[model samples]
Target: MTGVLAGALGLVVGLVIGTLGGGGGVLAVPALVYALGQDARTATTGSIVIVGIISAAGVLARLRGRTIDWRTGVGFGVVGVPTAWAGSLVNRAVPQPVLLLSFAALTLLIAVLMLVRGSSSARRTDGAGPSPGTPDGGSGVPAAGGGTSGATAVLEAPTRRRATVRRVAKIAGAGSVVGFLTGFLGVGGGFLVVPALTMLMGLSMPAAIGTSLLVLTFNSISSMGARIGHLDLDWAVIGPFAAVAVLGALGGKLVADRMSGAALNRAFAGLLVAVGLFVGVQSLLAL
Candidate 1:
């Protein structure tokens, strides 16, 4: 019975990660603790293993689709490595209830942000046509006979430069936060990664999902390395759990291909809220 439950939970976790490019860690940790009777620390350590493998599978599944932004994903991962290690150090010192509560709060906050971003994106899509610009929606170059002057061109160049710098800073900041959360909470941090890719880097939903998986894979590796000496391996549970999760991840990729970006965001947001609430309540009771 326990084995059956573990497989079912693992499938759910993989499906969430595969389809949404994140939230596997969020679901996996709780399932391990409550369903499989593991403690918080063990569950979190195991979550890193499960989420990492499945994320790698997800990245491969999307590779042929050409939806991943590898450059951005690699850059994000690079920035996150040190921070993830730091977060793991802190994770060992925190109490279980505090850790769980913190995870719940962060989860809820990200869900709200996702919903807001989704609504804003929908509004922009519905109410406005694409701006006059390059094929990729960049600002148009001034025509020779147009009323554009050298002075205006000079001013626009600096403005565009500053905007680019700001976007880069935002990406770096978001990556650090996601990495810290991944190590500290034993989560894939995809809930945050997808939004960062879409809102900051301007990737489409599919691209963001694929790239998010890559980022998760990197963060998971960094986090797991930090736990090498601290955690005891529970292969009995983690082994079978991860196997079924890989299969579910493949199925999830197919589901994601058919869904709209807005629908995916909405669904992801709803799931976060539900899980966050449950985790929050449970943590408070334990405290």
Candidate 2:
């Protein structure tokens, strides 16, 4: 019966990842600890495995379309990898109750960000421009250039797009925050990454989402790597959990195609907030 419930829950989490580009581990961690009776630390490690594998599965379709920004994604990831290892070390030292409480707080924060992003998404749908939480820093229209040769014009386009010192610093900071949370909490931080990509890196929504999956996979790998010998493998639960999630994610992509964006955002936001509240209260009471 426990396995059955876990399977069903994994399917729901998978659906979120398949359509939303992330959020599987948010639901997965709490479910593993409270619902299926696993240790919080162990659940965090398992979440890396579950969500990381599922994210890899989710990115394959996007890869075929050449929507991923490999340069930006890898650049962002390079900063994240080592920070993730550091976070795992911190996770190992934290008390279980404190960790759970922190996780609950993080979940609530994610809920708020989702609400902000959702409102922004709604506004964009109404012609407010790029998603709401992201303020367009300058005139979004590209600067015009004139040159005698077409080759020079083409060459200049990329040179103009080269990363400014400001851009590198911003990505490094963003990578640190997202990587720490991923290593400590077992989330991919797509909630943060998608907006960062769109707002900072100037990626479109589709491109941001696709690239986030790759970013998440690396974050998870880094987190999991730090826990190598200490990990207590739970194949019985993990195997079934991941298998169902993969299938659920596949179906979710199909369902996502037909869903209304605003409505989905609102609904998902509410669910996140409610779950966050529950986890917060429960963890607090246990302490």
Candidate 3:
């Protein structure tokens, strides 16, 4: 019965994240701990397993339609995976309430960020800021290459090399920080990734969501590896919960393509603030 309920909840959480491209594992860990009665350590471990499986499923599905910016994803994963393992190890050492309180604070911070960033996203015009066509620091749209089409000899080469490199650096840095948090906190870190990808890396909303899921897969594996010997193994919890999360991820991916970006951003911001306030208050009460 407990497993069944957890799986059902996992499905709902997974669906929200996978479709919306956020919130799946953010909600999953708490559900596993508070509602399912798993220890904080076990819940963190289980979250890694569950998030990895579900994210992999989402990535595979997304691959059918769009080319995953693999170069960026792989680059970020390189630093992210190892850091994720380190994060898991750190989580094992922290006290439960402290970890929860930290989680609450981080979530709240993400909420405020989303609200601010989302508002900015709305007011901005296509060519208003430094984007693909503005100055070097802005979007950086380069001139056409030497080769021309038909009668002329000019190749259409935008400033891909420098732009790609810069984007990759930002993505990798974000991945590393997220991995560290995941290893330390035992949460999926999607909330952080979405905002980071958007505000820092400057990816499209859908791209950020998809890219974050890919990062989550690698991060989960790393965190799980770190937890292997340090803590008690509980396949009984990890297995079924992960299976359900995979289903939810598929649903989230579908929704991401359809939902209004503004609406999603606002809704997620509200959720973050509420969750943050609740956790912050909870932490104070326990002290």
Best-fitting candidate, scored by TM-score? 1
Off by over 4 Å in 2: 117-163, 259-268
**Consecutive 10-residue window with the lowest summed lDDT within model 3:** 147-156
Q: Give me the candidate number with maximum lDDT.
A: 1
lDDT: worst 10-residue window of model 1: 130-139
Instruction: Give model 3's TM-score versus the native structure.
Output: 0.83
TM-score of each: 0.91, 0.81, 0.83
Kindly report which residue stretches of model 1 are placed more than 4 angstroms away from their true locations once superposed.
Answer: 129-141, 144-160
Cα TM-score of candidate 2 = 0.81
Predicted structure 1, TM vs. truth? 0.91
Better of 1 and 3 by lDDT: 1
| Candidate 3 residue lDDT tens string, 1-73 | 7768877887887786786565666677777777887776777777777777887888888887652556556
Q: Candidate 2: global Cα-lDDT?
A: 0.78
The residue-by-residue lDDT of candidate 1 on 1-287, one tens digit each, is: 77778888899998999899998888998899888989888898999999999999998888788888898898889889989999999999999988889889988998998899899888887987657656666557776667777767788899999998887787789889889988898887888899889888889888999999999999999999898889776887898899999999999998999999889889889989998999999988887
Instruction: Give a tens-digit lDDT track for model 2, residues 28-60.
Output: 888898888999998989988998888888777
The alpha-carbon deviation from the true structure for residue 161 of candidate 3, after best TM-score superposition, in angstroms, is 6.3
Backbone clashes, each candidate = 0, 1, 20
Query: Candidate 2: deviation at residue 268, Å?
Result: 4.6
